[model samples]
Target chain A: MLSKAVQKYCVDTLCIFAVFLFTTNVLAHGGATIENDRCVFRSQGYSIHFTAYQPSFSRTKELCRVVNSLSETIIVLDFVDEALRKLPVDLILKKQKDDQLYADYMLVDERIYPAGTMQLPMKKIEQGSYRLYVNIQELAHQHEVAENVHQIAGFFEFTVTDGAKEKDQSFLARSTWLFYLLALGIFIYLMALKYRS
Target chain B: MLNANVIKKLVLSFVLLTISTVLYAHGERNQEPFLRMKTLHWYDVEWSVKNEGTLKVNEEMTMKGRVHFFSRWPQVISKPDTVFLSVGTPGPVFIRKFSYLNEVPMIQSTGVETGKSYDFEVILKARLPGRHHVHPMFNVESAGGLVGPGIWVNIEGNADDFVYGVETRTGQTIENLGTYATANVYKWHAIWAAIAVLWLLWWIRRPLLIQRYLLVKDGQWSTLITLTDKKLAATMIIGIIGLLIYANGVTKEEYRYTIPLQGGKAEVDAVLNPDEGKVYVKNKKAEYYLPGRSVIIDAEITNNHNLPIQLGEFTSANLRFINHHVPAAVAALDEDYPDELVADSTLVVDDLRPIMPGETRRLHIDATDAAWEVERLSSLLNDPDSSYGALLFFYDSNGKRFISEIYGQILPTFVD
Candidate 1:
């Protein structure tokens, strides 16, 4: 009977561990997949190559979504299509709080970029979850004029944190601690049962 | 005489070897996303392989494309001050006959300006027999190789039967440049390998390390090297020098009219303006229906030309979707071109009527195909920014073609 109970306990623990592993795997590969070896952000029939850099903190490294440092962040959107250069586009930076979005920064006004490149220098941004939206001004105008027409735009989500310290508080990091505690608890319970026997 | 375990192990070994031989070609997806996206954007790439399904030895293929040096080049990589255009293939599988960028020969590295597109063409001849993936690539000065779309080509026949012949400027015909001086290379390598083996054996035959250290500690290190060893070393050094002098004399006598390899970049003229037709296309809205596997784009097209025009083709990321109704676009597909990239279903226009001269009309274009999903381009719907870009070709009544660019956000609809 004792051996059967131990087997049941082992199976239960393994099942829980599997669930944890599966959830973390999904989270890691959740947003923004690489296509043709490129991190492309598509806006209605057009695409832009999105890249971020924290030059003051990590000059040589190219960042995608996470900004490790609180320093001035440089975000560059490269137009993959020449047609995008002719359209007027704007960008908005918003922060998420309690499922509500609040505008944090007006990164760009509606303007045509002839060079096919838009560089946004962000400073004084607090640590939080933020969304950067690229709005095509022409499409936005059409949306306003027509009812039931959605605005044509694209957006990417990123998290700003206190570098390594905040990274340790992430779900994956905290789950690691939980995993160790669970294992230790199991080991201690087994030792107690062995002593009683 | 073999046991059951031995037979099992043999079977396992065979399976492993068979699996290893089924390797995939082109590891382009292994590169960092930033480098592939923000560096050089390749567009309108067209590859033509002669006898594509089974190209015989010595047959030729061509890859032509346009590469736009992205203006927003990544800061992590150095600027492409000097770039060399080359072909990417499994080592020496195909020999590059000629490579031209903007009609100028790309024998050496050349500087390119950002925000400009350069037309390039590369001709390659099959050398090895097997399946190979070929890509048009550019090697930046500091940055590594930036590759374009890769196409798989199959070569049949024996590799040994392949020959590359060339005619020198002095009107001398070299029978096979590929095998030229091959025997001399093997002879020199054998001679050097023999000398190295003799030298290694001479040292290995002697009591090494501890024995020599003990002699040194006893102040009898001089005994470690006998007079015979010194004489043999001197003789070996003299023999090497003599061989070098003899080889130099033989080479000078055999190739008296040798010319040094040409260096310096060839001057290429500025990129010519592509003849974009007077037709203009404005994207009203676009959506991709998931269940139907189709992309529906609504746009307003204006015809400024004197003749009425009809939509001919929609091309994106080297994939061509032709309008079957337009004979001109369908005729453009070469017989040797890969059929997998072309959509089986023709592009559908809501209104088949051609827009008259000086008339603007709203057109709904439906590009439906399993190719969108097969090419993995439909994954754009899952991307954070779901936008797409495509070139629309308009053909006039006289078969004159005009090009217009269309770009807009594409939303995915679950319900068709």
Candidate 2:
């Protein structure tokens, strides 16, 4: 039989551990984060504002990193750095098939765009884990200083799912387990109170 | 005496703390790329300080540029229906004296449309003594700040020497805006803080949380508040009302000449009509040679002007490819212009003969430079559109210039 103090300690520890787990789950991600109320793709010294839309499905709704429908999607890449507008950039979209990546769509815009905006439209993309790669060609003078200078490149991963499945696995679905843990903690705390009285 | 382990740990901690301080610097780079890229495109930006990029405290500098609202505004962010033109600095390192959009004062938020360009000028006075990076920025109503290219500004002199004086409409001279009313602000804050602390202590002097919870659980929570507590709460509220009335009367008597902060938007028309000179260019075919890092453009050029003209420069996406053979073209490049954006190798023309007036001739021009690959323009050959556009400048012997737009499909050639 356990003493009242030990029981109370176990319950307290359980509640703290549950909160820690919930916080970590909310903060964990591969890439892409919310900044100033908008989704941004960030890498070392480079950033591209990423926004997607499915005009055929949801005309006005804007998407960040995830698309519910497998319909036609238009992705806009905004160059955050002025220098990026002077470099040639290539966008390649690939999906995983049997542990190997295959190209789904590609756009090679190898010109300096004074306007600093690029739009990529992909039609009827399949549902899977897709990786979008941004390849920025290094300047010619950069190579003169070093014989071998790697090209600057970065990528972000996004997922495509059916609308129903996305809604089914929404916040309530994920938080069900958390709610159970919270209820258990409260019950234990109440029993401790009853015993003290 | 401290042991070796304690001393070593202390040194290691000091080093770590020094390194951590660097992480808080350069927050401009931390902004997400989308806000910077999709919201506004700044071009033809010129930052000029009064004295070669160095200024004494209270000295002024100018930042002038054109801002283009990107045509394809991101759908995720709200439309830029309202925006304020402002300068981005590390806080009040510099005080903005005046800001104008298309020659109209931009004192408040105004609506802006997409696919339009506006000229802007911001005059700033140095306030602090340090090297700082400043950028022209626009704060959209829903979206955050969209910053432009940053330039380093050197401010020399002691920060204490800076002062901003203003003469009000009442002919009263205020010495410094920074220190004005600061004492009064502190006094009011201190008075409020003392009262708040007293109220907190009065409540916290009794049992809190667990005891209160027990009383609530036992259905005796109503008995927790007594007549004395109600009377004390009423007295505190009455005291706060009295203090507010007294402060208002004292402020009205002390500062009678104060004016409300200015509010209202200025109207400025942003319309431009560029002159397209009497030189016509027909892009016959364009090819990019992978090995040579060159783009060869074969075009039919027709000069409508009376004087014989030569191809002098080709500018695309703000990169100037100058023809060295044309002395006038080389002279046009300003000394302050960025060297990297100017190609080292000039535009190579197959024929040196000038095109006569009313004569149309097909000539091959090679824009060969390592910059083509460096700038990633060579990738356009593989673009889905496979099209390119550029401005061609023609010059006569007298240094007279004519401009024509050239655009056509471009093909890539892997072989030399």
Candidate 3:
């Protein structure tokens, strides 16, 4: 009976976690998605297709995600939204830490680009974990408050390992805290309902 | 102990917050509020074919307006010296044929002065057929594209009849825009691809897997590459090198006039115009956005001039709200006639009472237009700090024009 209850608890927790993931997908594109064999990040109806090629390393191979290769990588952002063509997009790649957006944590070179195909200068990064932030700002209207600048930012996480393995986790493993709360609620409700008789 | 009600409330709050964040992901309107605030202010906005109206495909239309580079230009952003007047519709919804700044053909980069209003006119050929939101965009050499108010344009008809032809100065006609390349790159790329495929096929034709297995098993595995194959590969490599050299020499001769692009920042004056004593906006506030989609602003106006002037129009962003009565006819006889008053009409403004000069008077102004919803002005919605900037145009009895700036707190209107 104890074993069965534990199994039910685990299943319920996982299911709740799945629901949380679906909700928080608004934050990011469930981390990211591969479209047309390329990594495309979609959030808030805006799409930015990401491509990273090690021209100094391999000419034909396209690697979007950082892996075991400690190479000088060339990252390219092919804007899918036409609106992005006019907006100024700034990219910063630095070590993952709190206040990464405001702090001068930029390891790679940074400059605002006119938004067509922005090819960031090739960067030679040592093998480690890092986060890439793409900050996009569009022209605000004349009536809008001039002091407050609203920005749309996209975050991508990557890791450089000795030998990186593939990630194929269940929904429960990759979800927000809301999902666990939902799962726990459902589990409690079910337990109460089952014992009421 | 958390009760079920508390838990339910918590979950509901979480869901609402998540939805709010998703729905209001900040992009254009909210990003760089300072840039939008201090940059050029667009006024006298007019679309040749009225906005939200349908037009036949390939129809030529113009969007004419004025941009005032104020004295309050920020020093943080790139100096706005060399600016190009540009128009964009989501993407390439229309083909821009000609653009004029103050009646000067401004396709190439042009310069504008601070505290000066430049009249912008763009002639667009509707190559695309659909409902498109077109905006007046300005491109700075150092800075990026600064997009203005967008108007919805519906282009009708089939795409087959759209012709994007430009007559060259030398009497040559280039019909297709995309096919203006000089070199026949496609043909050369195809030939190279074919050569590579044939070269790969030459080696794959022989089923050398079984032969290699046999040779390895029999201990005579050193015979994989024959002498003839090596000689042929060497000759082919030498031939490729010779072809590459010949191609480079031939192309260099074919395009001898080609020059590298010279792109650098331009220097222009940020001259601020001395303020001539005119009407000043004092104590301004927007009461509400009525059901008909109009925001009413109660403003106190002080006419500094000697003559009594009437508030003719209030333009915010690209939306126009004109007075109904006093000057029933457009002041086309005014110095800057068609450029300023073409888009102005008496049907927009709510009141037309004249405010006496040197006297401070409170006037309730109603900015009524469908553009409020289309532009998604937050002042009409329920949000804190929805303050906006507006250009108030005052007119004397003699049809003389005097413009003033209104910068004050604007709060979102909530209906009871």
Candidate 4:
């Protein structure tokens, strides 16, 4: 037979676990999606350009056709130095029509540009690492409240190594091994503690 | 021996006293309407005090009450509407070690709707020892708003002298706030903790061991030592309770510095009144080199208030346009207005000129649009639908200041 103290301990443990699980569930989300496919990030001396394409598209014409197939999109650009939060700069570009240029209201960059290839100067970029995130949401062009679907276009990581050496550039660098090692260490430590306790 | 009835009465009285004192303090603070209205109002504030490891410690934080939008009156919103979580530390002191907004790293900025409730959380590391008032700060659609000014936090130690270290796999070490340091706070805490546990174990078990050794041999000895055992248990319970309370207070003082953030909604009303004189903002030209040209605004000020007042300062959001007649320097666009386009509002042409009663004076303002070159991305004309905001500050014969905010399209007429 279970003693009163043992039963009480079990009940209390269950209560605490239930509270934790409920809290975690309340904080979950579907995901973060991009609103526009076109965007830009400008620092002091250079500008970063971003473009999104369907994996199925192999040629520039196919990419252009895919771009035309979409109705609405949102692009968010985030800028950061080595260790600080900074504002994301928006870019505006124009797209070319059939022998005529028209302002595509729905397909413009943050600066409201038309659908077409645009070039930005390096002078607009500040000296740091930057991320340009483009989220493409295509709503059914016919309906007012069409179901919107999206895809995450991968980001490009680059450094503004103007007059500076690559080794000296202290921006976003690929060092996943470090994070992986830390995770592994934590896993082992937790396992050891679990068994010991 | 204390009977169950006596024990029950003592516990009940202690609970009543604690509850009543807490309620009375809250009641006294809620009496003043201005303090109730203007003071920092906090809601859904969560604070967690943790050890060196990311272990769960104490996670209890309360928002004293709900917040109300200050200066929600129409016709004046110098700063665009924004809500932010503010804590009283120099700035991002903990480096945010690890944080979440609705479980995301993003800072919470959902506009406060009146009477709507929201919860906030902050994970604070063991930093400086001091008691500080941290409040949730919000930037409303206009001039100034701070719900609670400060939280009386009693901190006993300095943060600069504090340190925590994390041992990494590659023999590398990471310090709290990502700063590199050799001091390890964890080692010190571990040593102190070992001592505390040992002391508690000795006191609790020492009496039981003696009773087992001597009293087990005779029934008389066991009966004689019953009082001693009861006294030992009581003393241990009291000591543990005292330690728990002391530890909680020290955790708040030494490690946990809460940012008492304020939350609430504001209502805005804008209408044209005949009696209220209209302020015209006109410029000969609108476009200029973001760094080169200046756009001058001329304002005709008329004091409607019976008493004379002086215009103290003109501030919008994070931009202080005019302060005490002296104009602030033109800051970098990204640094000043992170969310919106920055308009040059430094009144360099004329500084701190006063307007008397029943008199209208022309105020000239030269806003230098800094030089910014746009690389046209295959476009013939620039987009005209860009969002631009304008604001004006006026002071009457009295020290009271009135503000007028304008929102319209800024048509940049290009001159080649």
Candidate 5:
């Protein structure tokens, strides 16, 4: 039989472990995701196909399909740095007819509509650098069909200086696999500790 | 002396570190200044009983504390579009009565910036009594993300039977949560506070230590008296009283409560031109489920004017019209539209062609091979009054606008 002190120590450790697990459950909130990387941004003026994924030697046509479908997909974009976002800039979509297709203009300024692919043509914007932001408002309702209303939001880095080369769209791709892997590893370790104790 | 000073320094550092660690571990307190300042300061809260002396379960109104953002300092750098106003519930724990941000209905997701004061108020109906902390939360779309600070409010009961109705100042009855009652609840708290103070005082003043005396006996039966041991007794008595008083004060301050609502309402006229001519209306109802996600819409179209209206565009929210003018595209029993932007759910339109005068059509649209999931009910707080309902814009032969309202709930469902 263990001594009283040892048994007391074990009980204390178990209690602490239980509290930690309970708290972890509460703090681990859900998040949003974008399934693919290759996307197309189209408006009346231009339809540009941009690939944000690595071309693997392995056959991954299914992966490519996932990337292609993300063109019109809305994402929840958050500003990482406050100081960078405070810069005075505007995202202007210059109206141009690519292949002679007329585009309908939405009257709201600074608002990007993801109703259809390609941003509406921006007109008469002040010269500056800006990051484009797009988001869809997800509504709440009860019917089962209302579940797929994920609002597609997009962000693009643009500059308005004369003769400014449009910033590479590749700048938007981010690798969060490391963070996910770290979180998963920690989660597994915690689960193992919990089960063992 | 050097050693003693070193020891004192070590003890002081240890105490400071303990306090700092406690404060730092409390993440909820430091998140956002707005959240810290604008907690619903609930005081003098009361719940009145019904005719049978049993508490009225469904008819309780919670007047949350009036909350206002700090009007000065550290100006909110982002514009109104960056921030969002939100309430803290573990889930949709309470049916929101009427919530106003800065005295205006919080209809839009875009929120108020910093340095601008706002009063938020919500009369909540009685909900399930899980100890939930109600707090103010802000979401910045791109810049300065979520700032959430919370306060605790304990509730105890089941939530299913809760019902809320509103009675406007004009006596117009609209279903709403009950009003604020402060006096009754605070009375109980005040009584408890006084009792605690008394108990603390009584314990301290109850003669903690007995005085002793050592004396030489002058005679066998004669009582002998000598110098009393007052030094240790004095210190013990004073220390105990001081500790008790300090503890009582600390306890009173620890349970300090403050809950305020910082919101308001706005009444603005429509900026867009209203279509006054032909009232082309479509009242369509639809249900969406995640398994092979489908939109089953029960549709009805009505032409109120003498002239025939052609609905070339049958749109729901932001989804556009496809083959709406196609004559051969018959009124489908179940027609599915491509939702490329947001997959999994399909947009169902009743008829692609125009309806005749006073004609009603029913159509069902379903989308297969789409990956769909059930959305949370909390998003409804964004558009509470259903003012931004589904619209069907029709046109006359001359291209004048005819707007119709589609009435139905957009529900979230699960597949697995």
Candidate 6:
């Protein structure tokens, strides 16, 4: 049996450990974060923000993952860096499949887009994951990238849920998950410590 | 003695603090609220602790700021697709020496994310004279300008003694920036003025106006332009013609490689909605202010392309009434002047889900966002007729884009 102080100390340590893990996980992915109620995408260290919506299903819900919806969906990308003005960014989405690693079934594939706010919406979606491929080569480099965008590219993986996983995803929820996890661990540790004592 | 030494130390520290505090550059006050609360939210701002903010005309300084694009994308606003940064004092007060987006010298559009804050460092060379308000401004290509806090800048004097130059590929250093063009304009204006004066003197030497009046008054009056006068006029005309020809020849020879201006409509595939390429936006109807904070629409859409497309955004009058089923933040409208450059969101539907090729669907969509209210679009009081317009954009997984326009009149209702 342990003293109350020891129990509290152990609880605190476990809480701290849980916090560290959760925060590290959240910060693991650079370039994308929800800050102050906004969905921002960071590329080349510059912060680019975007919006995603499905008019038929949601009006206030902004999406980071593709959700299997009963209706059409839309996503908007806003550029904040002038350096991207002349660069031609190519965006393509493929259905993640087992037969092929590079899925050819493109749902949204645009080549050589001018810089600005761009929207990618789909007429329909399935219940699964999606591979969103973004290739950044200056529009001047279009001739070189014409055959393939892999010359200079980075991609983001997004999941398509059945509306359950993304029901209440918000900036606050995503950013504060670590803290919540910490609290949960602390509570569990405290309960265990109390029972042990 | 100890007390005195302590007081002295305190005094010195206070003086140093004052200088450091007031020396940094400041931006406009009104712009701060809008820049922070609206368009682009700034955070984690870091500036040089060294710049106490006084700078010489020829001297350079640097400052940095961060923009945290949040996810509260409102409808009826443009996305910040093309953004610019500059130091201004009512006008461009400092010539940008260098600008780094996220610490890298980014000269073209840079990729960024909403809900993330990116740092920006700007180096400026003070060029203008006098004490002016200095601030940093971010401009969206089609959106309004957003300005930060303005600081008082006292530029002592012009860098009159300073010279600027550029090294040419041919190994020549050209220093004259303005005098070359200015001197030519002055020379042409002086020549034209001199010619006008000479003509005036020649006309005054004879009562030209009176002679013309007399000729009109009396048919028998000798013709004002006699044979000698005609001969003189011909000689002057010939001289002018000869001078013009000589000037044209000299210019043609001097600028032999000049090319005529060529401008016209460019040829490219028109961005059309894949679903609506062959199908028009038919039976379109709208109900705004649903639940007092949203707009709902029902429309018939058909995809003509072999590929499927999804509705991405609906934009009009600089506002993006996007479908927010996914993560989205409408680029804020720059609240500054020059509404044309207000950074309105264009019809780039890069993320509308794919509608199967040759599929026609009747859809009901709800455009919900408090931005609709914050932008005051739903409660516009200026227009009694309450007419408005919007454009619907569609995109496929392949990234092909399409657009359609809509016009409607509103029936204003109070949320109170």
- For chain B alone, what TM-score does every candidate structure achieve against the true structure? 0.68, 0.67, 0.62, 0.31, 0.28, 0.41
Cα RMSD to the true fold for all candidates: 18.0, 14.3, 23.1, 22.7, 21.7, 28.6
Residue B128 CA displacement from its true place in model 2, Å = 1.7
- Cα lDDT tens digits for candidate 1, B133-192: 788999988888888767788999899999999998889898899888899999999999
Docking quality level of the chain pair in candidate 4: incorrect
lDDT (Cα) of model 3: 0.60
TM-score of predicted structure 4: 0.26
In model 3, the Cα lDDT at residue B126 comes to: 90
lDDT tens per residue, model 6, B260-358:
663332121211223434434653665554223445556777887666667766643333444433232222222332221222323333334556778
TM-score of 3: 0.49
What DockQ results for candidate 3? 0.02
Q: How would you encode candidate 1's per-residue C-alpha lDDT over A21-123 as one tens digit per residue?
A: 5544433321223333234666654566666667567652456677787877777676555456568988888888866766655567888764455667666
DockQ of each: 0.02, 0.03, 0.02, 0.02, 0.04, 0.01
lDDT ranking of the models: 1, 2, 3, 6, 5, 4
lDDT of candidate 2 over A66-165, digit per residue (tens): 8878887777565554466567777777787876766655555566554355666777767877877887775766432223434356677788877756
User: Which regions in candidate 4 have their CA more than 4 angstroms from the true location?
Assistant: A1-70, A74-197, B1-87, B90-203, B206-227, B230-392, B395-416
The number of residue pairs in model 6 that clash at the backbone is: 104
Q: Tell me the TM-score for chain B of model 1.
A: 0.68
| Model 5 residue B87 lDDT score | 58
**What are the iRMS values of all candidates?**
16.2, 14.6, 17.1, 18.5, 12.9, 13.8
Better of 2 and 3 by TM-score: 2
TM-score of each: 0.53, 0.52, 0.49, 0.26, 0.26, 0.32
Task: Itemize residue pairs with steric clashes in candidate 3.
Answer: A16-A179, A146-B33, A146-B34, A150-B30, A150-B31, B322-B349
List where candidate 2 sits over 4 angstroms from the true fold: A1-197, B1-44, B50-52, B70-76, B257-264, B274-333, B338-416
